[model samples]
Target: MSFFSRMPLFVLLIGVAGLAMLVPAAYAAATAWYEIARSFLFSSVLMLVLTALLGAATAGGRRPGPHGRSVLATMLGVLGVLPIALGLPLAMVLPDTGIFNAWWEMVSCLTTTGASLYAADMLAPPIHLWRALVGWLGGLFILVSAVAVLSPMKVGGFEILSSPYGRSERFRPLPESADPRNQPQFFLGLGADRTTPSARAMRVLRDVGPYYAGLTLALWVILLLAGDPGLVALCRALGTLSTSGISPVAGSVGVHSGVLGEVVVAFFMIFALTRRFWPGGGELRATETLRTDPELRLGLTVVVLVALVLFLRHFFTSFEQEIAASNVATGVLISLRNAAVAAWGGFFNALSFLTTTGWNSVDWQGARSWSGLESPGLLLAGLAIMGGGVATTAGGVKLLRVYALARQSERELERVVHPTSVSGGGRMARRLRSEGAYLAFIFFMLFALSIAVTVLLVSIRPIEFDTAVILSVSALTNTGPLAGTIHLTPSFESTAGFASNPWEGWSGLAALPKTVLAGAMIVGRLETLAILALVTPDFWRR
Candidate 1:
């Protein structure tokens, strides 16, 4: 086996990620962005040195087993370790920025939160590349870990897959990795199952990685051909697949993309909200084909319905002024074109927000723009809370759980409305109606509680109630930029008579509040109940 293939998956990942940092360092050198290049070199060297030390320490001993310990260490290590190392260079270069701010920027990216402290134009080219690269990798890390780590454990959205009140799975420890002198390492799924976390995680990665990688590659080439700048295309491509929405340019795909490019991007963003779009993807037996996938169907329905509402709102609201400027025939033609553009904007933005990608459509205006009117901020926030597919990079309350909870609600109503009605589907379907729905609802309540607690904690620091609410939702939804900028609130003029943005609301705050939001970001990424469940004895006893 190759050296990389032989190493435990998490260790292999650290080594590979360290080596990957070298590419940007070389680019920075070629472009004369020497300071940021130095940062990359430092991070890379430190990462490799750490990896080497870990590897040598494990030699001629029972290798560290991929159990809960491996999973937690790797997850926390990635979140805690890389950012500090990466932040050092950033602090050295950005003289005004303290260590905390530098670390926040990276943590945001590494979480695929993509909420930038510094705007794209303000940063050196290499730094922009580094940010995009880190977000891109963060996105991939989420994807690989989702199918490998989260799904198998019945955590995240996969919690719906477990039968309510079901016993934990138990299995014999793998003999191949076992040693006579060392204790056996066992993997537990919800405290029931036993397997090697490393082997299973690596197997899922091997099975799913190439296909996902190729899809991102194809997207990159298509975007490049559609007229995006090279670096912008790279970020967009990676951002789209990962749904991190990191970009080299300001605005988003809609701002830079020509008509065709927007169309292309919209198509690919579908991959974020639905796993069935990927090869070797999820199979909810309820979805026998692409058309049957519940998440996709629900997402499309939402986009179209919301788009139609927004389209009519734009068209009807603008009717008098549009009719005044042109002859009746010319007015009709112009109105039709405007309506079409508005619908496109609505559909695209709704989908984008739903996936937590954080792109505002080209015509997503604070005030009426040439293309269309502003959408309701509330609408975007609602979609963001709805979230995307389970086991996909997109973050929110995943659509699958949402659907499960909804179906369960509908079934209860049916029971109340018609006592004689038979519950349809099958035995498992009926059980899902009762037990599955309860599990999903529990998650929903936990999500809401997290938001409430976050808002309460942050608002105590003098953040406005509205600002506090948005920050809480944004962080918990894994869509950090939602609070970074806003068009809602009537206008940019603050009550104090200063022109301010929503980012100012969060960004201008003291470090303690920002730190609170950061913790919320991690909570949203990890999911609330799953983390709590991980610690309870119930999770380990099985």
Candidate 2:
């Protein structure tokens, strides 16, 4: 602990990331991926040596501070440096690839962005697992940072949500005689009067880290039992937990897991949609439990409502277009079946997008598939816009803030209806409803501005306007697969009632345009608010 705590903060984190990569490296060795194993092993050694050098140099240097700026800087440093280190192996393996492209691939994985520069078939199983593993670890890092570092700073998603609570999670006290800057709270970011920064971080890791690993392991085992291949099952478990929605195989999970497999993935994806499932850092309250959880309620409601609407719409349309059916009974039965499939498709896809996992349903055969009509792409996009819970692995604008906004609007409507009607739930509740809504709205607008800016920038490189828009949204949502271009322009397929995003396979995009989307992915993961807070004059003043 003393040795690690002496290390420069970024160096310590980089060392940890390097160590984590060894898991995949060992796996590569076992699978006869000698080159891959050598690459990772060498990277890990280099990182550790760097850690030693930094630790010795920083031994007499200033310690980490409580200021959110430092925390943000550390985070940005990790996001930038770790990807390059992780991509070292990839850059060596992939022919004709520059360091920038390889780093982009690692950035996508570590950010849980799930955008692929190479098709699954092009990569070995070990390499695919490495990507999934990177995403899974990234999710864990975000979770720990959210609870330990960012939450105290009242940045990350913490700014828009609850106020910081009293009483820090326990740890050993730093010596009273220690430098003021080396106070325990300086590292943890809160008033935790415990051990050194390394010890405090490890304490949090010890308590919460196992749950993440356990959940992924349990799901991985289940998926394997459910008939997915070993590598695929492992990737699926990691992807679902991370909400990266990455698949080891070229085809979707449905292709490998079947209906039963998709069901399992869906069940597990609920964890990403609500923080109630993950062990809570805050005090346990009734509302935070699954029974009364707002995220769960709204998510389920959206899933059910959207599914029903899609099902009924398809049912009626199918029934009306029953020209091929010779018998009335046959026509009715086919319509019923089609509606059932459509409903499930709608439900599965909606929840997936809402959680920002971005998994397409097995039945998403597009507009020209088994049924002549298209599955609704715009509806899926809207759900993606709504996002998942604030603290969870999922990304987007978040449902909690959306619910707050909706409640605020409803309260306003009620006041209009009866001018003297008192709002319920006390003053705190009222404030949360109104102030929370305003912040959420600001975040949304900022998000919109970011999208506009990103699209404009990308379009300057000769990218189509609509493609820029979709790609920007997809990147901002941390739903990389969503950025896969959907055909919107007039074409033969459009004339024949079919559309697909040719850019879905990201490798085909021009290097300059790809860079634009990659930048968006980084900004999205850090989020609109964090970026603003990091750069704000007021924040710096503090």
Candidate 3:
């Protein structure tokens, strides 16, 4: 147990991923699918053997200390190299997907992008479970890394709230009497302690893993009661908690759980909007609570305003036409029902996209029918770009950054009206309005630049501009399902057919573009700043 626990992060992850295959193996065995079962069993054994060899060689070395760079590199490996290792069984089982496609699919799920090359009916139930399980593990990895690694390093979105990068208290020089190499490190951050990186990571998993798994299990049971089949419910629950948006079926359109299921899922989506939902994620200020969280406020505001616009866009037009075509009371009742449906759809869909989960409300079709408009694909993309709260499963620019930018903009406007006005929100508020805002703006701009660069790369495939844009945004936001919702503009021939879906579009792409999108997903998951930090010479010299 000690040797296993002391294994390097990548080795540990590889082993866990190997063990994860047993789930599908067991399922396949129970269902009399021995070929598939053998494939998984063989892969699991191979991975464990590899893990044991690697762990034995490296476990006794100078124990990994609190080196942020190591953690960052492990994360990159988890997103990139680990997927290649994890994809073997998948490639064996899904013969149509070559090793490269299998690797790409695992990359998508591990980064919580949840993009698939196969149609829903193409893979068996066990395969879908594999994808969802991988995604769930990926989500847990993000959470643990966010608090244990990124917070101390002052990278990720924590830069907005932390002292400037490389200047954090955690990075201070060691005392003269103490040999830095011999002493344990103690840094102030969420879940920080006097321990090695691997120990710290395991501690966080122990603390946070249950809540993560329990939430998924609870949601799964509730979804089953709501009418979804067992496997379907389990996948949905895993997808929801992980914000992976993966499923055995299609989007909510493919769900049998109906409006009630959608409602329940939507309620659970709130977890992505704020880190406060988790242990050790509460506000630094005793006075602040979830109700007062700026991220939550900004997220709710965005959802409500976007939903309202979506509802109103077709409400008046559809209402007037219906009233003119029908008798008075009948027209009023029907129009009211349509309005209600549209509102609910807008609200649900808006929340889904904002969290980067990419769930299309089942009533989204009804909303479109009532509003007399195609799905607002561009608008959904915009919401995804806004993303969810910091240190959560969802990805994008993040709500805290957005909130900071908004607060700073408001302050700037006030300054414009009164030259001598002082920002008066207290120390934390002042920090947020000043340094926080500046950092947030920088990240937002970097995020935008990432999208532009990704778009350029994808466009090189000779893909249409609209499709490239959607693909870029989806990949960079870690919101893969967003690519499937491209019905907003009619100009592209890609969206012309009823059978069109993201899988078809993505699968047809040349290898280069697909690889580029995969890289973008890694960038989105790790955030551009962390990647940049890795390349800087000073990071390695230390």
Candidate 4:
């Protein structure tokens, strides 16, 4: 299939996504949210007109099947376009800011990269809702894309999602065909065989989608029951499971300000992180798979270590001051519980955000307290860098890649000592030694490059290096909080150090820097290699 042929479908899909804004816009209008409604309607009209024109122009062209390059292009293009489209409404409704700043904000949200230009407290309710909605939609788009598109292409570390376990189910192969160009014919031949490879691929999506949607719905009900407003509850439910931390208000899980609410959100965040626990059908159980999965074990181990560090810090430090500032109180026993809660909250937050879901409900004001524990917040930041399972909607270096590197190092040490003894792992481990090393290296390099670019861009404004790094990492990884940087007492402008003249920083920035950051956010969410492949001429050669 030709690349150009798919352009219309892509445009139409984006327009459909844009048009979805009307539902919320209608609600806002009924409730007298004029600005919000106006933004939505105007954006919708613009998108509808543009999409219609594009669709008409390209409508009768040859349709394209799912090919590697086309899928990569579509995914990257969607990631780039959605923010640009949504930014129109934001820019129109927001204070007179340059389109670059507006694009930055929308890109942050839609990519589920939770970097925010405005402080949470300063944002109007409708604008906040729009941010949350964009995050939610972006997350769902990525999840669906992971299964339907990226999986078959074997890019973006999705190869891990197809891991073969000891008891993994086996399937029959497709029937042989005489014609080499008859690829579709071979696929059709497999339809006669119930256990064919193509059938298995389809089954994976069918099984995973329902599980994802079901968990999301369950979280939604729980949030509503926990006293969240209907709209806010819906947004969080979608955003949280998808790991998109775009919140209706600045403070994510902390926004609700209820113990039960926090607990509920914390639990859900943990659930999203543990791929093995997610309900799905297969001979292989995720828990059983986890027993041998070094990455999952390592990630969990990191969480445990972080929790202990935080617990001791809370027990010995000036705990009252930190807790009091956030309006959270705990007795000796409750303090222990709070520590556990905060630990789990931080752990899951790291897990989810690294996975690129960016959900958070923990108080940012209390970040300094965590910092005393030898900077556990930094540890979480490191975890976000490590990332979660493959084919999951998370971002960062990914735990599996880290595990592969560790395994490779272990083998290298053995080789140094004996030079002849055979390694004990399987074919997969051997493959990791060869192909996986290169991929892992590229992944980490890109991850580091993203952080560097984000830090440089964020530093242009009046912010500290540490805070800027945290924000950059969080946004690049699509994670929400940057450790102790969340301050709710003063408005976000003051807390973020942007009160006096935020735009003044822009005067120093050329157009290229702004475009680069927006590009970085998209690439980060999509994974750098995927973006590279999409733009590479060789990728389209096939």
Candidate 5:
């Protein structure tokens, strides 16, 4: 079959790619960054013209229908084209960055992975705005794709998003008629009368689009109220809830360091990590859905346990030291309050970062000093590795797959002790089989491989193993902050190097290492499975 015959999604992707450029172009004009503005305008025009031509060429062609391959093709095409298109302007406008580095930066932003190669302080206002806008748009694409494409395929840990009524078996939409929609309608087609998969996907998009936009708007307003600059607030609102972590300012959340701001971010980060908030008209109870999900349960438990451990450690060591360091009794009281605030900050910080939102407003060094919090940063790193729910914006090993693997292991252990027992009869066992553990195993293995590759890539740099692990986790999980020392700046230019001069010329990192790190960030954000699935022929075959 012709490539376009098998995959018409390229047309849709071309349109999206064209649309993506307008944001940066607008930002350039608004910020009076003429050089950047010109570059963006030129790039946007080129892309729009080219894509429009291609879209026209591909029009008036009809295929049987879209399959998993078409969906994967669309996703892959968008992922590949978007970065290059956006990067063109950056390479042209930025003082001294190669196309490769620019592409990396653009990919990281678009993937909602906050990894950056550019120093925030060094970037012009237009460029920074461009990055945040791309990140936000990237997040929206992922959210829409998750529900419209990935969920139906039962890939990307989207099993929970599967139709609760088991309408996915034949890959058909739920019947429209309340009475006529019967099980036979599911098994056999309605005698050559049926809605196409593409049609259903479009319907789902139409239904969910408003909810997505509303949530984004709500987040933007909240961030604005938190005293963020207008542009920065919009960026944060989009970045935080999308778990993208891209920021316009140098230090991100740490730049402001307000308690209320951090709290707001923490709440949104939590919201993003969950699948329950996605709007659809249903009797489905959101809280109950979350409660019943093993992954959610495990993720929440891990967060709580880690928070308690860190809190106790901070209260004893850091809090005591801060109190002693103070001269006045009032100073001691102030120190205690600081410690309390910092402890709360650290807890929420870990939670948010683990969920891969990476919003940090608290002073890490001061928190450690005031609360005796030794390496609560490491704890956050660990949580990021653990990750949040499956199919979430958060990256990492994904809690559901981990939970499934753990449960399978436990069941096997029990069966080994009692071979004759009804080991497979349990409700959980039935659920696992129906959900397909083989796929989860494959996902876990792929996740591990990605991490290994990322670690190897980072190891080529001057970073140590522990630091490499942290960086890998941060990038792969889309969780920012390296070693709890590095805050949001996206790239090593701001986060790495000496404390005295963070942006002092990428002093420690060589070109190759920077390149590899950037690549890892892109891979992590798009995710191992999504990319791999695109390449797999099996996904294309009926």
Candidate 6:
């Protein structure tokens, strides 16, 4: 343990990732997939040995405390460089796919993007298990970093709590290595002691890791009981908990567990909507506050609104079609039942995409069929952009930022109507309305800029404008499955194009495009501000 304390976070993460390979290796061995088993075993052993040597060499050095910038760099390394090592076994298993493809796949999984170059049926079950496992670990990594690293840095949604005017003496503007002045008050208020960031991370891991694993285990068991195969249950369970949307059978749409499984998954998806569902999440808030948390309320609102729009849109259209084909009374009853199903489908899909998990509801196709309308692909793209709560597995601009912007808009509108009126919702609300909203607005603009730049870089190839937009948003939002689901082109019959779809999936893309998307995934996971920090001269000089 002391030896490990001296090694950097990146080295430790690599060692853990290597140890994770053992799970797949053991499964492959049990299933008699000997060659695949051998690949994993060899990779695991190689990584562990290298990490051990590195740790020993660092044992005499000063312990690496979790400073904000160093943690950010470590995270970047985990998402970027760790994949090269993690993908070794993947490359060995899929020899035909080049090392770059394997690296891209691992990056997608490690970033919890859930994008895959290989189709659902292309990889062996063990390979899929490895992908899901990597994503699950990635989810844990982000959760820990959000609490320990970003909270102190005030870069993640915690920026909302920063001094509205400037850096309050209470909260420093910049984080420094081992600076006692830079403690994260928001998280520190949650029962965590004023300690180094690394200690806080370890404590968070100890508190949250078991529940995270247990939730995944519990979900996996329930899915199996719901009639899914073991492998499918395990993968979906990991995907759901991680918000990765990874699946052995493509996605939730392909699962055999049916509506029962979707319902169960939906219950667990609430975890992603707000961190309060987990330990250490209710920072500085009263017990009753969880019920009225802004993030939770905003997330639910988005899901319900999106669901209602789709339901109504499809219901009216389906009722008209049914009436033309049947008697009025019969059409009314049939449309009611169809509307119920469509509502459920819309609700489930809306929540899933809102969390940025990218899971398609099983009944989504039925809903589309009832309406005889093209899938509302753009609506999903929008939901993914809204994303889930701060410090959760889901990724996007985040719900808190959106909530802050909304609050600011309301305050602005009130001032417009009555130029001399005092606005109040308590100090927290006031902060959110003022500087929090200011920061949120800046982030929103930066996020949009990232999308435009990514789209521009992607379009340097032969991709169409709409296709480029979808792909860019998908990557930047860390919602990889979006690329395949959204089709901007409409057929002559007013349905999504099947015959002449312009966008090919990830595997069909050129090397340059894939590389650009991979970079976008890392940028999105790290968020823009931290990435900017990496390039700043002051960050290096410090």
lDDT of 3 by residue, 1-542 (tens): 56655778888888898899999999989988899899999999999999889888996787776766787778788899999877899888876567888898899999999887777876777888899999999999998888776666667777676654443343346576887668856465553344666777788788899999989989999998989999999989999999999988865633598889999999999999988887654322211666788888889999999989987886887888888889889988988888888888899999999988888888888777665777788899899999998889999989888888888999989999998987897766877888889877778778888989998987786788887888888999999889878842322322212222344467667777889999999999988857556544435643
Using all chains and alpha carbons, the TM-scores for the candidates as numbered come to 0.87, 0.88, 0.91, 0.75, 0.80, 0.90
The collision pairs in model 5 are 116-490, 116-491, 317-372, 318-371, 318-372, 319-371
Ranking the candidates on lDDT from highest down gives 3, 6, 2, 1, 5, 4
* Model 1 regions more than 4 Å off: 1-13, 60-70, 165-195, 279-285, 370-374, 484-506, 529-538
Query: Which model, 4 or 6, shows the larger TM-score?
Result: 6
Against the reference, the lDDT scores of all candidates come to 0.70, 0.72, 0.81, 0.60, 0.62, 0.81
Cα lDDT of model 4 by residue, 1-542, tens digit: 23333444467556766687786688779889897798889888888888878777765765654545656666767777666787787777764655666777777777776656665566666777777777766765665555455544455664432333212233446656455666433121111222322233344546666876787788888888888887678777767766666665645565664657766766666544444554332211223455775556766676667656655665556466456655564445545655665665555455544455555536423543443543455666776777766555666777777876877788889899999998765556665665576567777777787788778876675556765565557656666545333421111232122311232132233454446556766777777756556543434644
Model 6 / residue 371 / CA error / Å: 0.8
In candidate 3, clashing pairs total: 0
Off by over 4 Å in 2: 163-200, 281-288, 366-368, 488-505, 529-531, 534-542
* Cα lDDT for residue 69, candidate 3: 70
lDDT of 5 by residue, 368-460 (tens): 666543555666766777776555567676676677677667767878998777656444444554444555677767777888887887677
lDDT of model number 6? 0.81
Candidate with more favorable, higher lDDT: 1 or 6: 6
Score candidate 4 by lDDT.
0.60
Which segments of candidate 3 are over 4 A away from where they belong? Answer: 164-194, 251-254, 281-287, 488-503, 531-542
lDDT of 6 by residue, 1-542 (tens): 44444567777787898899999999999999999999999999999999988878777877665445676677778889999999999888877776787898899999999877766665788998999999999999988877766665556666666543333323234455555766554323422234544566677788889999999999999999999999989999999999998988854544598899999999899999888877664432312567798888889988999999999999988888899999999999999999998999999999999998988888899999889999888999999999998889999999988988998999889999999999988777887888778878888988998999999997887777887788889988889888767764321221111221223356666777778999999989888857555533334442
Give the candidates in order of TM-score, highest first: 3, 6, 2, 1, 5, 4
lDDT of 6 at 303: 93
Sum up the clashes in candidate 4.
14
C-alpha lDDT (0 to 100) for residue 184 of candidate 6: 55
Give the Cα-based TM-score of candidate 4 against the true structure.
0.75
Error of 6 at 397 (Å): 0.7
Of 4 and 5, the candidate ahead on TM-score is: 5
